[model samples]
Target: MANNDDKSQSKNKPFFEVQKVENEDGLGDIFFGVDDETTKFPDYVVDFKDEIEYFISVIQLLYGDTKSESLYKKYYERLFTIADLAFNSPQEKVKLAERSLHKLKSELTTSVGQRIRTKLLMDYLKLAIWPSIIAIIIVLLGDSVLTCVLAFLGKGTENIYISSLGLISIAAMAGGWISTATETRNLAFVDIVSVINNQRGILVRLIFINLFSIFAAILMIAGFLKINIGGLDSLQIVDSPTVALAFGFALGFLDKVFVDRVEAKLSKTEAK
Candidate 1:
């Protein structure tokens, strides 16, 4: 009867328990229960053991003896508890736990300095790529659209192919992309989190930059805005395709400056 009782108790035992074992090097290792054939854990659970151990070591390296050390210690403890549950869970339950662990790991790692910087570059790339593609499409179709518009207005379509508007608009887009990329690259890691959080705003800004550039190009073409290119012997942007494109690029590149000035003026008016 006693032998049967002992077997029942062993059968009901949890698969793993967390214990700290000190090695000869005086460093502690996380031991997940005993290594025996009776403990049949899935391969993913076993793999996660190594990952969690490594993560703990990284936390120690990053936050050790710092003001945030205690807070991170609490985080580690919480993760350890979840891992403990996962190790003892059934296969179906383990999968859910695995996803939770991965999410936690991602969130923690994203805040790391190097990771944040990489994310900043990636975010800027996403912001730049879409607008550039749209600009290219517009450029390719611009001549057809110009010809149609001129025909509708009873104007000559003969010089539509020579029009500088499309090229200038695309140049403006390129300038905006460069300007935004420069700003993103110069951001400190600490500020990157806020930038990442405001992805929608950044995307809108890119769109605005493209539209503003197009509008400025139109104004120049209509003689509402004039720019005299230096060393071009009094050649105005409207008269010279190459000069017009350059002017559009400058307008796009200085978009941030223009935006800031306008905002400053608005703020002053509001203060009064």
Candidate 2:
């Protein structure tokens, strides 16, 4: 019985020892050698509170020195944690997450208000990027596949098809950046007002983006019109204006699908 108890205790000792090592390693990674940078750890209990107060004071100072420093650091930390968890995360979201983290790290400092400003900027950037990237992928797919489908269906012009792809890329980027700006700044009349004084600016920019998208679409369509109208022999299919119209309508349908996704996100956010 005594020998059995000794063996059981020996087995438990290794397990507990391994757990303690793991916990220490985790703490060390989080602090990232900050323990070496600071002075000797205080001996007494009150020191922990004092250290926290000092850290807060440093953060406040940095925040004042930099633009949205505290917010930026917070955003950076949050996004960084997400990245760490999803290191093997799909390529689709990895770049976006990395960009946000990089922006915060590059723009922010640990000293004071700078971290806050950086955090805010990072979050704002994310709002613009996440949707825009998804939109870009959709636009790219719609342009490529839809164009090919239209051509097969006797409704596409090569010039128009190629131009649509380019136009969609530009439009998607614009929409993403603009939406991010509005979201990050929390726009006027929203629950969290991030852009308190830039209401007019936001509206003006949005108007310009919408007008620009229209112009780009027209330019692409016009380019298609310029393509040799005499190439009927090469394609061999009878070109019907109705077919062209139908193809245009199909593209519009894709746009509606994209809009629906945006609306759903908005609804979910509002509900939250």
Error of 1 at 146 (Å): 3.0
- Lowest lDDT sum, 10 consecutive residues, model 2, at 14-23
Q: Give the TM-score of candidate 1.
A: 0.45
* Tens digits of per-residue lDDT for model 2, 1-272: 99998776543331100011112212111221222333433343233323223333333333333565555366434533534432323222333544554454433333323333345545535444554455456545755676778889999445444334334444544543545444544221121223322332444443444344444344435542221222422121123333333333323324444345445755877899
lDDT of 1 by residue, 91-131 (tens): 22456666777776666655564554566556656767766
Top-TM-score structure, candidate number: 1
Local distance difference test, candidate 1: 0.62
lDDT of each: 0.62, 0.39
Name the lDDT value of residue 136 in candidate 2: 55
The weakest ten consecutive residues by lDDT in model 1 span 226-235
Q: What RMSD does model 1 have?
A: 15.9
True-vs-predicted CA distance for residue 209, candidate 2, Å: 3.2
